[model samples]
Target: MLSKIHNGVPFKYLIASFQHQPRPTFPRTSPLPLRSRPIRTFSVQSILRLPDSKAQTGSRHKFTYDAAASFSAKHKDFNAATHVFHFNPYNRIQTQKRPKSKRPASGQDAFFISRVGESNAVAFGIADGVGGWEDSGVDPADFSHSFCDYMASAAYEHKPDAGDPTLTARSLMQRGFDDVCRDGSIHAGGSTASIAIASEDGMLEVANLGDSGFVHLRLNAVHSYSEPQTHAFNTPYQLSIVPASMLARAAVFGGAQLCDYPRDADVTQHTLKHGDILIFASDGVWDNLFNQDVLRLASRRMVSLGAWKTSDGGILVADDLKPFTQSLAEDSAQRSSTLQSVIATDIAAAAKTASKDRRSDGPFAKEVQKYYPEEDWHGGKVDDICVIVVIVSEEGKQQAIKSKL
Candidate 1:
C-alpha cells in the first residue's frame, strides 16, 4: 500500500494499525482552515529580557553575525568539511541559470541565506519538502529548492523605501510562497518552513510553520524555541499547491489535502546578545535530537575553539570572534574553516549519526511511544537533514571574564 513517509515513518500505517491511539500534544494553536485568511499582525520587539547591554540604555548597538550551514541527505554520507556553507553578505546572489546539481546536498530539504538588500541585516531559513508528494509522482525537491531560491531573491532585492511594507519574517515567507504559486514550473507540491531575520540593531524575528523550527541559545542554555504545528501524528501543517485533478479526486473521495498558508506561521521576537547561538533546522534534525543535545554539541565546539570559555561566574564569550568567525583564506575552496562552520557541521553530523542509531531512541521515537504504546517503534527516524547556525556578536562589546571565586 502507498503511504506518506515523513521522518522515515509511514503515516497511513500508524493510522491504520492504531486507530484509537491518543495523539501527541504540543503547545500550538488549532489548525487554521484550508482557505485564504488575513495575516495575523504581530509586534516586532524584544520579548526576552536580555542581559545588561548598551541596547538596554536606549541606544542601538550595532551587531554582527557569523552564519554557516551544513546538511546531508538521509541516503548519503555527511562530510563536515565539504558539506558546509559560509554566509557572506557581500557575495552576489545569482538566481538565474542555476542548475539543480548546484543545489545543496540537502536532498528534499532546502535552505537560503541572503543579505536583506543593502542593509546590515540578514535573512536565513529552511524548507522541508513533504515526502508524501513523492508518492503522487511529484519531485518534492523542485518545490522546496525553488521556494528557497525565490525567497533569497526577494530578500536580496528588498527595499525599505520602495513603498513596500516592512520586511518581516512572515512577509518574506508569504512573498516566497506567492512567487511559487505563480511559477508555472511547479505544478503541485508542499513544504514546511522556518524563517528568521536578524537586524544589525540586535533584534531577531522568526516565523515558523510545521515541524521545522529554530532555537535560541545563550550562556549554555536553551533560551527559546519554536513549537511544531501539526494536525495529527506525523501530519504537519504544510504550505501546498494542489492540482485541479487532485482536488477533484479528493472531493469525490471525501478527503482533503493539508494546505496551510504562510500567514499561519507562528511569529516571535527576541533580543540577540553577544555569543548567542541561533539554530534553524528542518524536522530531520529536531526529530533526531532534542534541544539539550543540540546545546551540548554546540557548547563543546564553542569551548574547544575558544569562542566560549569557562569562567568562575559562568561561561564567558570571547572578546574577539573575528579570528574564529572570518574565513582563513581569500580563496573560497581553500578557506580552511571558521568557528560557525564547525558548529554547523558538528550538529549536522551528530544528527545524522543519531538518525541511523537503532538502539538510542530520539525525539520522534519518544513521541511515537507516547501516543501509540502498541506500535513497536524504536531508535531514530532518518530523513533529509539541514541545519543553519548563527553566532551573534556585538561590535565593540568586550566580555569580561570573572575571576575565580
Candidate 2:
C-alpha cells in the first residue's frame, strides 16, 4: 500500500495504471457554433503539482505584458491596468494510483499557468482525466494534458467584448475540444476541466466541468468558490466517459447517457479586490479539505509567511522572504518542499478531526463516507490532489495602476 496527500493532507494511496493500447481512429467532432453570450457578474471577492519538493529557480515567473490590452482601454472608469499575477502550483502522484507492473507512469492530473496573450492577464487551470476510462484501454492523462493545453491557448486567444467573458471562454472549450479530437496525436479519453482567467481589468472568470474547482479568498477569509458539478458523490461529470466517440461532453453517472456537447460547463464571473488569493484544485483537494479548513490552512500559511511572495520570478523564495523561509529551508532540501509538507500535514489533521465531528455535514464526512463506506474511515480520502495558489498583492495592484498611467 502506498501513502500520499490529498488536499495537502496524508492518506492511503490506491495504485492503478492504464495499459496503453494502440490508438484507434474516431470520428472528428464538428466545431460548435460561435455565439456571443451574456454572463452574470457577481459583486464579490476574487480569487501545482510540484514537479519537485523544492521551487524551480531556473526560469523567471511567466508574467506576460501586452501593451495593447491595457486595463484603462478596456474599462476607462477604473484607472487600473491588468492585474499582474503570480502563482505557486504543486502536483504529486498518488502511490495507490500506480500500476504494480513495470510500465510507464501515467498521471491523469494536469495543471497550467500562463499570461493571457500580450496582456498582463493571468490564466491558471487543472484537468483531471476520468479514472473510469482506464478500463477502456485508454490513458486519461493524455486527454487531460491536451485539453489543458487547449485551455491555455484559448486564454491567450480570448478577446472579450463589452466586458463580457462568456464568449471568450466558451470559444476556448468549443474550439479547443474540436482541435483535440481533430488531432491524431491524442487518444479519446474523457477528463474534467477547471479554468480561471484573471483579466487585465481585474475581473475573474472561472469555467468548470466535473469535480475540479477553485476557492477565492480575501485576506484570510473565503470570498467565493467555483462549485463542483458532480452527478452524485464520487461521480463527477467528465468530457467523455465513453471511448466510442471523441467528443468533449459530460453527463450524470449511474445509468445516465453521456454526450459530446462541449458547452456543458458552469461558468461564473467575479470582481476581484486587492489582497485577494485564488486556490484552484482538483477533486482530491476539495474532497478532503472543507472550505473552512482551506481557509484555516491558508490563513495559517499567510501568517507563517509573515508577508512574503510565494513565487518570485520563477523561484519559490524571493530575497525579502529569505528570513521567514530560512527556517523552512533548513528543515527540508527546498523551501517549497517544506511548505508542501507542512500544508499537507495540517490538512490531514483537519480532515481527521472533521470526520469525527458530526456537527457540520461538510466535505470531510461526505468524502469519507463516499470513498471508504465499506471500511473504517480515518484520515483523508485517497485521490490525486493538485493545488494552484495565486495572489493579487498590493504590489501587483500598484503595478497595474502604473501600467495604466
Candidate 3:
C-alpha cells in the first residue's frame, strides 16, 4: 500500500466497505454548498521568494499558444518520447468513455488538455491522487483520472452562447468534481487539483486547491506562483467522495474525512506575454523541487533552443515561434517530442532524480526538518509526477493583418 510520513507520524485511515450505486447524468447545477474549514498556515522558509514582474510590453497583436505535457510514474521507468502529450486544437473530442490504455502514463497522477468548445481557447490542468485512501480499499487513481476526464469533456462541449454562466476555472473544477461524485464506479477516493484556462486574448485564470500548484515565468524570471492550501502539515485540502458507510463510521469514531469543495480553491488571474511560460504540476514535483529550480531548468532549455535570446538591452523573445511550435508530421514516430515536450521531460526527469537522491534535501525534506528537528527525514519524497508546460507566442502584426484581410 502507498504511504507517507510527516513529523514522525504516519497517516492512518478507517477502513469501510462501500455499496455501489447507479450512475446518473452529469449535473448542470452546482453541488450543495458546504461550510468551509479553517486551515493552519505553514511557512516555507526555504522557498525562494521572487519579485513580481510585468509582462513584456510589445505592439498590439493577436496571440496564440501551444502546450505539451510529460510525466513519470513513481514505480515505472520514464521514457521521454513515450510519456508525452502534444495538444492539438483541431482534434476531435471524445464523446464516449476513454479506454484505459489511452490514458497518460502518469500513474496515480493525472492531467488533461482540451479545446474550449469551438472557441480559440484551451483548458489544462493536473490532479494528484491522495494515496492514503488505498488503505480503505479504494484506488485513488480512479477518482483523479475520472475527474480530469470529465473536466476535459465538459470543456470540449461547453458553448459560450448557450446563455449559461461564464465558464471559469473554478466552475470547470466544480463540474469535474460533481461528475466524479455522480460516477458510481469511483466508490470513494480523494485528490488535489490545479486547473487553468488560457484564452486567445492572452488572459489566464487558475484555480488551485491543495498542494498541487502552478508557476508563471517570463524572461528567465519567476513572475508569480500559487500557494498551497493545507489543513495542517502534510494534510492538504482535498476534494473527496466519501461513502455513506465511511461517513457513518467517521461520525461515530470522532474522526472525519478531509473533504473540501471547489469553492474553497484559490483563484488567480494573469496576463500572458509573447514568450511567457506556464508550468502546472502535481505535489510530486513541488515536494521535490523549488520554484526557482523549475525556472532555472525552463530558462536553460528555452535559451538552448533559441526560443529566448539575449540582446544588449535585455533578454528578448524570438521574433517568430512557429519554428519551435510547429506541428510534427502525422506519420512521425516521435510526434510528441516538441520544444515544450523537451522542457517538460527535462523537468520531470530532474524531479525523478531528486526524489531518489538520498543526499539532496528537497522542499519536503526542509519542511520535515522544520516540523520535527529530531526526525531523520533527509531526502526528497518519491511520488508520481505530472507536469504540463505551455508556451505563449504572439502572432506578428503582419500575420494578424494577413488573417484579417
Q: Highest lDDT: which candidate? A: 1
**Tens digit of lDDT per residue, candidate 2, span 1-405?**
223222334322111122221121111133322211111000001112112212222322322211110001111122111211122221111222122242112246666665554445667777777655555667677677676666666655555543636444545666556766765766567777787677545677877887777778765667887766654344456675344332212222212333334577888898775446576766656655767777778667755655334444421322232233112543442333323233433443444444334355446444444454543344544455555665552223444555698
Candidate 3 C-alpha lDDT tens digits along 1-405: 324443324434333233221110111123422222211000010111111112432436555767888898876888876777777776666854466687777888999988887765789999998887776678788888889999999999988679767789999999999999988788888899999998767899999998899889999888888888876566678898988887786667655667899999999999998889999999788888888889889989788778899889888888677666653333465353566777888889988888877788888887666554555677777889999998887756346646787
Candidate 3: stretches off by over 4 Å: 1-60, 327-336, 397-405
Clashing pairs in 3: none
lDDT of 1 by residue, 1-405 (tens): 333223455444222111211112222234533221111000111111112322332435577777889999878999877788888776777765246888888899999988887776789999999877766678888888888988998888988778778899999999999989998888988899999999878899999998889889998888988888876656678899888877776666555667899989999999999899999999889988888888998899788778889999999888877777774443574367777777888889989999988889888877766655556668888889999999898866753333222
Per-residue lDDT of 39 in model 2:
12
- The models' CA-based lDDT, in order, is 0.77, 0.48, 0.76
Predictions ranked by TM-score, top down?
A: 1, 3, 2
Q: Which ten residues in a row have the lowest lDDT in candidate 3?
A: 40-49
Question: Better model by lDDT, 1 or 2?
Answer: 1
Please state the error at residue 126 of candidate 1 in Å.
0.4
How does candidate 1 fare on TM-score? Answer: 0.84
